[model samples]
Target: MNETQSYLTEVHCLECGHSMPYRPDLDFCEACNAAWLDARYDYSRAADLWRPGLPGRHVSLWRYRALLPPVPEEFRISMGEGNTPLIRATKLQASLGHPAIFIKDERQMPTNSFKDRQGSLAISVLKQRGVTECVLASTGNAAVAYAAYAACADIKLWVFLTSLVPPEKMREVALYGAEVVKVTGTYDEAKKIAANFARRRNLHLDRGAKAIAGKESMKTLAFEIAEQLARAQGNHTPWQAPDWYIQAVSGGIGPLGVLKGFTELYEMGLTDRIPKIGVIQTSGCAPMVRAMALDREQAEPVIPQSRIVVLSTGDPGLAYTLLYRAQKENGGAMLSVTDEEAFAAMRWLARTQGISVEPATAVAFAGLRKLVAGGTIRNEETVVVNCSGHTFPVEKHIMDDQMVLDMKLSQQAKSKEQGLTEALRRLEEQITSVLVIDDNPLDRLLVKRVLQSNKPYRVFEAGSGPEGLEVAETRAPDLIILDLNMPDMDGFTVLDRLKANPDTAAIPVVVVSAKELTPNEKSRLTGKIASIWQKGAFSANTLLQHLVKTIQTGTPSTAGSDVINALQTLDRSIHKIVIVDDTPADIRRLRRFLEARRKYQIFEANSGQEGLAVIKAQRPDLIILDLSMPDMDGLEVLDTIKLEPDLRRIPIIILSGEELSAEQWQRLDDETTDILPKEEITPETLASHVDRKLS
Candidate 1:
């Protein structure tokens, strides 16, 4: 193949088999809108892409550019993704009584997951095609991956994430500059809103299977595996194929890409045979596995019941039929593992191989273990397992404490404008203070430089553990960055003493050291430390990001604490009250009663919309809202107020004479809002409701 020429022929419908010349604008088949499009490459024009460990050849997924969608040098977007390590799982193989089990360690990917390949390819194509903005809905990793690549390409992106995804994952994408809109419903529901938003805004919508370039990116893993295997003997070694290829699926995109890759290898005379494929799913949302169990082409959409959000793609779409046919043709199997089993698999893999993978990836290993025990996978067969991605979400739990102002299920439509911006703004305003307790001057200076480089942090330093404790006790910084080796007093003693001391006990510590901890040391430090980083293993930027997170983990943030304090003193500190009513007479009456009850500063709005504007701008302590209003009604205003994180926290008293219907009562009661009858409203009746709500 020519260096710059792409052999990519066309994109075709998997169901209808209708093909069209590849176009960046087209996502679905023209003939069959329901079925997703799959990319086709004219393999006769293709040549060998494997030049492993060779100088001047790219080390990333872009190494196989001849087979991938072509992009100009200027438009190419990459973070050196792919080229992940494949380790022989010697311990796992022995335990399973299998001859060979190799982990295609996608944990080594740049974004710490295989989805980086998709991001790299998809963003490169989008940039090459001059597409400026795009939208995606992902349970977790994919959103982060795509956002990172899009950041590199300088493309605007909005990501819709499933609500169940750990808060850390949402924060990760936001860090990558993606506008994050979280769905309070299922993963599929988020997809609907995201796709609609993309169309409404006239931007690219990247959906699984339909995202042709992203789907095509998965095949590069097959290429790398082949190249790696060939290089093991010699770079010139003829193609050798594994007996089995297995992976966990969300939308079943990974295996579909692998199937296409291996088939192409066979057609191109690189591989002698295609491997039998195995796809795994979490039992909580295993539509394809369920369908495969009954020999059905597809299964009904499942409501995701899994706590493992990343693996919960409830409906597999065109992926079912395409993967099903491929599996059947290749003598493969589809299986599901429970969350418990996946968690156990995560522990097992880490215990045996020292590989900590996310629960989504563990689902495959769990299924692999089950398959081998059931004799579905023979002991003599060589199996390759795709450890697709995740360690980031599993390790971090800091997003909860951060200023993550998430929108509710009913608030998604309104979120497109205000939600993500609010979240990012709040994060920027959050300040964390750090104290460094390292005896090494260079290391202490390094840390101080990194922290100070970021912004607004009050960085304190101590040369020894005792001095550090003294400073920590007096200053009570938000977090401490400590080093293990110190003169006169060691870090462990400092940790014990700090935990024992009441004043400094709650301060989180991040240990940065050159020393490698043993099992006993690791166990000792497990609950004591927020995180550990080896001195040279991390960059200054990475250390800064993690240090900030360490300050936030496990405790309510500084901002959250301030909010709590503010809420506690509302009755005494807050003086502003907004009376939202259409009638000037009613507003005057309510204001007079409120002012007499307490020394409150009264604000007035003539209409519901006007009231919302005033309430938002003034951020009143309480709201006295009239139900009956012209134009925007009280219900609409209530919805808008409750949808906003800042506005929702304020106390609302519905002082209206209007007889509310049963449904309106339900909605109001659900919000737990206080209601006072306008007809019965006197100084005493209104005061009781206002006092109770404010108090």
Candidate 2:
């Protein structure tokens, strides 16, 4: 197949043989008007093309750019959104008496959900077609992601959701500059209203409503998992893909997408096996599960719906399609878990893996447990349970003390950031004192309990960031654990105070917060933060491990000698490198180059504010600033750099492949010393310029 137009050449209807025009704005089938639209590519032509170059593309869903629809390169927006970690579900396996359990961590995506991929692609298509506004009706995650990406693209977004939707989810969506409409009825009804509104306003509609395009967006997950498993098992045996694939089902786009990805790989002769997929649902409103059991083509909700609201999808048809497809193709089945079961599973995941998941995600874990207990799933088959959401309930749930201990033991093997030696040092250093700032009494108590596990550490608590800072000033502790959302001056302010003050700055502080952070959030928590461990990400043992690693270690391995040797081969003058674009391709290329050239450290910023922070902190000898950014313009950044006395001395290079006008050129010349157009500057060329500048 030709790599350029492989999986997406035309839009075809699943209901009818007729094809539709390839317009980004036109989502459904033109002929039958079927809502589910499949992308049809010239497969035979694509097959003629040789295997794609691995390690050649960005670490995103765009890595499969050849198979994606016709979105221009310039308009594609991404934020380290794809290639989520596929981890061993050791705790889940033990609970289910299954030896080979795994998890696909979609919760780690940019917007704390798997919807980042579709949202990015949707925004890209909209941008390509020059559409200025878009509206989406989502239960939760998808709405938040679309809002975030639209905000990034500087486009207007309207999110139609139900009043029953969680306030936290609403806050996240609204924070991203989206206009939210809280409908009075079910999500499906809200979606219907949104559709009508879109038509009435002539707003650009994302074809995901019927599920085909949204389903296709998830194909990358299946491809990646298959590839990862293949690499793990090697060529010596018959291909054994995952024995079962389990995930929470709402619109059911993700699971269906996974199935499609696997089908594509199998067709491409990459693998001959496919996993038996498991669809999990909350017992409160399990329309798809009931439909699947009855072998029904459509879905209808179970009555007396339980209030574990996150997985509240009453529309069974959307869910039924995924269940039906998975069962037919992979010999899969559906598992419905009760509200209590899901809540318990969430606690179990938290205690065991130090991962906080909401009820929607926990349903998968609960279902997997049920499968194991019933002996429906075998102990030997490799199973992957998808952790779809990171949002745990604000209120703490009750679990026996023994349960926590057992769970922790089950999850002891996972490696988060590596560095066993560093972990040992930190633990041994003896945290003689501890300080915590959180309003929740339970949270404070839990943190204290975790901190007190090591007798050498003494725990102290603060109600707010300001109080925490005051405590730090008076009684400097060995470490401070801070929370982001506080009543009086947030954690950022407290962090600033600590970093600014010589007394408290050196003490390494871990940020413990409930909020999901973006790349900008990660970047902004720079100076004094040793690590940002979300409230759910850290446990007593994990904290202990970190302390042992940090304080007791002799010297940490920055990189191995072999890595240093590879870096030394590069020009020494290139001590620093900067990535200018928000595009995934550029970020991937620059990151890969810097990774190989280990001596040259890498930094990035989505907007001008982030870029400036990197510049001030790293003080790189070279800089590459993006011409276009949402918050601050590239020209403005250039102006700022020229104005700063110290920053002006650093040599600047234009890394963008974009062309500058004669007038723009004149303006740039007046501002900077060098303009290394991306095309003109190879890695070697970049190295040469660095050599010239330093000499």
| Candidate that would win on TM-score | 1
Q: Which residue pairs in model 1 clash with each other?
A: none
lDDT of each: 0.76, 0.67
Residue-level lDDT tens digits of model 1 in 1-695: 44466777888787688988877667667887844777788776574443223236546776677677767667778788888877788899888888778889888877888888888888888888888888898988888889899988988888888778887788777666676776677888778767766776688888765678867898988877776666553546545677788998888778888887888787888877788888889999999989998998877789988878988888877788888888778888899999999999999998988888888988999999998999998977778899865636522443322223243444544664455444334323332467899988888889988987876465677889998898787557799988887878988889888888998888988778877666666656655666567778666775665565446443211111112111112245546677888997787677667656545656667788878877876787888888889978888889999899988888888866878889989888844478888899999988888778777
Alpha-carbon deviation at 489 in model 1, angstroms = 39
RMSD of each: 18.2, 22.3
lDDT winner: 1
Supply the TM-score for candidate 1: 0.59
How well is each residue in 110-145 modelled by candidate 2, as lDDT tens digits? Answer: 887878888888787778778898878888888888
What are the clash counts of all predictions, listed in order? 0, 23
Model 1 has how many clashing residue pairs? 0
Give the deviation of candidate 1 from the true structure as CA RMSD: 18.2
lDDT of 1: 0.76
